[model samples]
Target: QFDRKSQEYRALKRYWKLIQQDSRKLSDKRFYRPMFRMHLTNKEILEKLLSYSDELRQHYELYQFLLFHFQEKNSDHFFSLIEQEIATVNPIFQTVFKTFLKDKDKVLNAMELPYSNAKLEATNNLIKV
Candidate 1:
């Protein structure tokens, strides 16, 4: 049986290869390195992730710069830019999104009905119309 540890190691190995070939313009290069380093317990891996996140996000060829940075000068402005990018990209996922825009405890408490009463209200409005 393949253990969970083995699986994580395999994922890490795949992650390293993904980073090393980041300049090759492979389809996986854009987001693979940060995703891979996200789970590691070591500082080196974390540094790699941080560096790659900055470098790739600044790169002109990839979509990362287009999303989070662009013409924005500050991190807050950049994050606001990213929020708009996410909203446009995933219109159907507003509630999963509110989870971030709102307080976590509140977001989790409201999770039970992101679509419940709202749908009924819309249905009632349609029926009246």
Candidate 2:
């Protein structure tokens, strides 16, 4: 871990936004080319930041899993396991989990189903308007 007052800690704070961004959306040249201004690629920055702490690495892995693996058949089970595992990792995660638990069935269904009712909801809203 880095000392809170160190230059490395400040750099980590500056780039913290990158941690939650979807990697696929960042594949475009325009999206990633700006990192060159600092002479550090996104991958390199993430590697350096993640290397600082085991919990941060685990959090990153969990975020990636939530983004990419939610469509799998066993996703619901995995999601529950992840919730349990991260229960002590961070308080923010626990808050998010509580929100998900409120709509747990709907959340699981969204993960399992390929199609969404978004269009239907939009049409309903249009009709109401």
Candidate 3:
């Protein structure tokens, strides 16, 4: 069992490296193909039991929105998207969505803050080091 897990971990790591390489390509399609392949691979691993790819795609969309479209006005839309995706038939995704929902207030508060605390966190980490 341990060996099987280790093998799976290594395979995923190599696949991620391939995806990262494609991410550096000039064409959007180049990056997309590997991501799509990875999604398919994930689905195969689960024996096509559920639409895990859709869940992953939705998560990616949410991530992109958070990274690029995070604004006070978009907060409601963000939460709505999360809720919509959470309603899907996937226990794993549902659990993850519930955790995010529980922390919605904190996430929204941080998004509304004018300044980021990333620099502060980095300085604190440096001090600890």
Candidate 4:
């Protein structure tokens, strides 16, 4: 049995968020440090957690692979690989896979585009204010 309130558990939760973070937009490194001072690196902590469950480790690996493809803007490959791999792994991912397929063009474009309208939108909002 695992104690959810344990320091290790808190560190594991942070680890989940860290792995998905885009390096370009990563926050202060100290913000992601473990709940308590520890000699172990984040990688070491993550490896320890992953060792606890094979199923969890498999899901994490799949997630990492998909994220890598998406981040690298391999839109076509991401779509196909996600459908073939992610959909079969779990019901939650099956839902996500279906949603991605439904908006395939938009999703792919977002991934391929080097820029976003976020700044323009912010400026527009400021003018209207």
lDDT of 2 by residue, 12-114 (tens): 7788877877655543223343433555566677776777788888888877777776635567665776667656758898777677777778887777778
Per-candidate total of colliding backbone pairs: 0, 0, 0, 0
Candidate 4: list runs displaced more than 4 Å: 1-11, 22-38, 120-129
Model 3, range 1-129, lDDT digits (tens) per residue? 125446445454445333222222323232222523453443243222223245544554455564454553478777787787677636876787798789988878777767788999999999999
- In candidate 2, the residue pairs with backbone N, CA or C atoms under 3 Å apart (3 or more residues apart, or in different chains) clash, namely none
Residue 74 of model 2, lDDT score = 69
**lDDT, candidate 4, residue 118?**
97
Model 4 lDDT on a 0 to 1 scale: 0.72
Query: Over the stretch 1-129, how does candidate 1's per-residue lDDT look in tens digits?
Result: 225566444544545543433332345223323535443433334335335445332332233343324223334544454476555444444564464566644433444333447888999999999
Using lDDT as the yardstick, the better of models 1 and 4 is: 4
Query: What number of backbone clashes does candidate 4 have, counting pairs of residues 3 or more apart or in separate chains?
Result: 0
Q: Best lDDT goes to which candidate?
A: 4
Q: Pick out the ten consecutive residues of candidate 4 with the lowest summed lDDT.
A: 23-32
129: Cα error in model 4, Å: 12
Q: Candidate 4: TM-score?
A: 0.69
Q: Which candidate number maximizes TM-score? A: 4
Model 1 — which ten-residue stretch has the worst lDDT?
59-68
- Model 1, residue 53: distance off in Å is 18
RMSD of 2: 4.8
